[model samples]
Target: MTDQTPLRSGGRAARRAARAKALPDHMRPIRPGMEGGTYKPLTEAGVEAIHRAALTALEEIGLADAPETGVAYLTEAGAVQGDDGRIRFPSALVEDALARANRAVTLFARDPAHDLELSGTRVHYGTAGAAVHLVDVEDNSYRECGVQDLHDAARITDTLDNIHFLQRPMVCRDIPDNREMDLNSIYACCAGTMKHVGVSFTDPDFVANGLELLHMIAGGEDKWRERPFVSNSNCFVVPPMKFATESCRVMEECIKGGMPVLLLSAGMAGATAPSTVAGAIVQAVAECLAGLVYVDAVKPGHPTIFGTWPFGLDLRSGAMTGGSGEQALLTAGCAQMHHFYGLPGGAAGGIADAKMPDMQAGWEQMCSNVMAGLAGLNMVYEAAGMHASLLGFCHESLILGDDLIGQALRCVRGIEVNDETLALDQMREVCLGGPGHYLGTEQTLSRMETDHVYPRLGNRSSPKEWDELGKPELVRNATAKKEEILAQRSRARFDAETDRAIRARFNIHLPA
Candidate 1:
């Protein structure tokens, strides 16, 4: 007598909506820190040979132009200094530093949700580089990059699901003062997104200014040190066995300030480094090992990434060919070396020689992105948005790259195998007792959203449906997505008081 009619609204549609809402975090098919290393480009013997060669270079050629501070640090770590002013690392010293280095590092984000655990062969892709120009896809032109552009890049990266982190993708050309540029770059990026950021300073003196801003954002110096969200991408070496004096000093400050360091050694093949790929790798490894000794000398057990980034050269023109097949092999081989030493490492990938996001750019971006993930690169830098060998950054292309990296990470996740996944029971039921085709079975309906990744902007409709939808191009859709994301104000920004204090203390250019 008390029973009433049950409320129902659009029965089938409501049921489908319920199924979509049931997919939770653990059910996601692809996620951060998926194990890789399935593609082994280097054999065991080859890795050993390369290691020995690197040690030989360090012990023989040595590194010249080591600053006084660096000299003291390295000398304390068992390195030798000759009367000729070259600091040479003995094989024992190099191995000792390697043994003491952090095998894994957690690159944290302001929001705990984005922390990346870089250990073993776990893979993560993100944005990186210091491109001088911004690509105007509408006009097919380029202009000098400014601080606002950098903030916008971070803002877009914050919203993208597959872009794991945000490094400084472009330079603040409008800010002429180096100190102001460094501090403002940190402010603008941190304000734009809470994802872990990677920043570089032109001078060691400027690093203090940048760190001051970071300290404010993290609430205090101790809090910043406890969970350092930013890493210094220090290019410590000038390639071919020489130290960049200023950058080395900067690296020292970064190590002591409790920030993680990417001991970057970028040797352009056929130009600064050897013409052969193996020869380039050997030089990069030796240089980074020297950096390793220096870091341990400053502070033992500091978090550092073994960054052996060797860019390929176009022999015909002697210009960089960062999108070449050879570049993929070089990065993959470097990952193998990092594995050999059991150290956390990073390498460059997903760069394009094409100036815009075209068909050529698509092929070039995917090749290295897939290989870097499969080769088990702990951190894949420059994995999106870079073009023209890193001379230009395209916002539209960065949006498109979100889809590419999602697919690449799925590849890294590989295929899961179990009784449930094999689905022998479901297969038999469909073939023997049920419908000839398995379109909407119970198992299929349950697993559709969890087992597969669908692109946000990539079109997969049939020809008729595509025409009906006006044949939207990928870049156009990417442009619309970029506009849509930028239109929304970011919730992950500093409070008004902090922003005002930063702007008042420093020459911050971002509008309040």
Candidate 2:
């Protein structure tokens, strides 16, 4: 027995070393575009009812304040402008627009390997927000977020396995000019990661300049059109049923430029929208349906995401509650609506109302993230690092969110009950004549990497082992990981000649 002990220990060490090595993309337990429709918050009848309500609202209530170009587009596409200047869509017009909308959309990345395929129940999680402040966990304070912070956040996101894409997560307060800020936002996000980027234009005028930058990055206008990597997250609608004029113009420009558009409708319950969850969903769906018609009018079958992001509001204080259970249900139900329409969709999730990455942040982030993934949201935006109900972004929280999302994705993967996964033979071997345990079995060793997702920073050690290892706190470990990732040279940055040309052409704010 003593002689065999050394061999057993060596074998265990070998297994540990094998597990430490990274698995190829195909062998990884969780990945982008995993199908997840396990937990449906809305019944089929409920989805149908919401769809009918949205159609009714568009037909009767209508939406007002469309830009001149948008009015022409919608009117040409069979919508009528009422005496009140509101565009009223007949049910047939809405049906025709839905029929012409692109059902399968692919959000391209600078690197083709990272492109996201959006269809069916496939899910993808990523970062997004217009956070004005950055949460400093060590200082326990908040400060205005700048372009440098945005770049660093993108760099960190590039290294995370679970964060499938990086949307512009913060505003560049350092750049005083909105035009410069818009351009800088594009550069910072594009430079920081190879994943598909999502950005918004503050003005329609800036979009031409933004496209020129993208053209240079993509080699030329023809190439950019062939594989447009960045999408315009256009908030075309202001609220209950009014078009944001400037944003609608921006959407038109984006669509004309061959760039994809996220037709975003962000209404707050009890504020911009109705207080009830179903009512809020109805309004958001109606607004996005209108935006969809506008997009199809500009160009038939244009790549567009049905972005129905209706946020939750704490009625008592009139504050946004992005982390509440109600918010989770709202996002899930919206995802169902997207599936019903057979359109690719996106919505908010994984937000933390807590100011810091603490126990409260953990629960809040996990609850929404898990629900969002289970609902099979095509694109889960603001899925990490958002805090204070989208007011702040935190680096440590973002790092920890990678682990949280990995686990959530595992839940989305759910269980496989086929012959191999059931493992009746293995169970029989263990319970009958074998070692009476499954540990150290051949099946266990073979399935370790394929069947389980091991968190990079999540601690699962025994108490004694943890104490011996210095009892590392979660945020401290996350901070260390953040430092390590940023300390490395950015692989996602453009080459020297391209970078130089970009800098020369634009007022690039990021440091060399």
Candidate 3:
């Protein structure tokens, strides 16, 4: 446990070795662009191509106004009506919108007031997926999501400080307990124990509950006013780019209310989008911009976070997969778009296509997260535990996300070109022919505390020592971490009377 070294000396076999010191798993498994996996992403040049294509989509691809007044503003901006009466964006108009946007802006959540600071640390972690989790992929088949799972997940996130927010897991049955009630239960549990929340988006009733929770923590409406409660306002766009009504409604609610909302529009290329990947990004961008326009239209400069998760159609299964290269490309490109506008960009992470935890899960989570990091995105929405596009939450997956976020955060800390880091004096000293052993230097000792990454499960010992210590997979390692967190004392607490009152209101009972 010395400050100079993160790993133990005698390996796991050492009598004093307590494996409690390793970094979380998500930070460990990362390789760029699937160079080491089956998945492949669009090249940097490809991203440039898509950027050009996005501009063209405004001009050539053009947006067709689907009769939504809120969406029609883009048409007024620069899009023309085609023979089909669709409002098509001209290249100049698309460029204008990009130019007009603010590159980086903080999103304020009004009710459960919070500020999403999205600079320096480019990515923020949060829950992923929506709808019901019919299949319990981890335990096999579908099972009802009970109170235990929700509470446990919230606890796990609360204990793990790296998780940015605790989002409700989509359960099979929200019970009579309507969807709103089910959501409230999850939110209540999360707000009760956790300090930060990504906040469940959609459903007006749930939104109200979220606002109440935010107000309670923030103390009053004035505090919420200064800092807004943030949530996502998603749009389901029809192909070639068209906005849905629900998206517009949510955007206005969060905006006028002064809460930060991420405008997300996911369209499949060759399906909900145009045939090409570039075409899809253009359409998706238009869809997101249309939502932003709503925010600006109602109250100009309303705190908004821009984002998209569009991907190329697999053409095999009609599912929206988050692990696609096009998805990565779109995530990165959208960051550019948001930056172009000087607005914070919302990206995604911890996405896995595997029905259960496996190599597929690990790989998808790694690449998707990296794309957001490399692009210098402001925040990532689907930042964790995304299996089947967020259908299920694997406990291990969430654990992995904490580490994944840590890695993404580390990446955005561009190389510091300071005197110490540049090592100029050391290089000069070495050139003088005197033995310059940096290993024992005070500078090295001080830097090692923050510079090097220590793993939670990565065995640093020689193979023989590792074999002697009994090789363990990452899951077993994570299981231990979970147990450790649960066992440790957490200072998080609420008043007993208030806890009891909250339980009575929600019809939930917590053991004393």
TM-score to native of every candidate shown = 0.96, 0.98, 0.75
lDDT (tens digit, per residue) of candidate 2 on 1-512: 99999999999999889888888888889999999988888899999999999999999999999989889999988999999999999999999999988889999999898999999889999999899999998889999999999999999999888999998989999999999999999999999998999999999999999999999999999999999999999999999799999999999999889999999999999999999999999999999999988988999989999999999999999999999999999999999899999999999999999999988888989998999899999999999999999999999999999999999999999998999888999999999989999988989998999899888889999999999999989888989999999999888898899999999989999988
User: Per-residue lDDT tens digits of candidate 1, residues 426-485?
Assistant: 989999978977776778867887888888888899999999999999988898999999
**What TM-score does structure 3 among the candidates reach?**
0.75
* Total residue pair clashes for candidate 2: 0
Q: In candidate 1, residue 93 scores what lDDT?
A: 90
lDDT winner? 2
Clashes per model (N, Cα, C within 3 A): 0, 0, 24
Global CA lDDT computed for model 2: 0.93
Between candidates 1 and 2, the one scoring higher on TM-score is 2
Please give the lDDT score for candidate 1.
Answer: 0.90
| Model 1, C-alpha of 99: deviation from truth (Å) | 1.3
Best by TM-score: 2
In angstroms, the error of model 2 at 42 is 1.1
The TM-score of candidate 1 is 0.96
Query: Candidate 1, which segments miss by more than 4 Å at Cα?
Result: 1-15, 19-22
Candidate 3 lDDT, 396-434, residue by residue in tens = 667766766566555554455888889888777765784
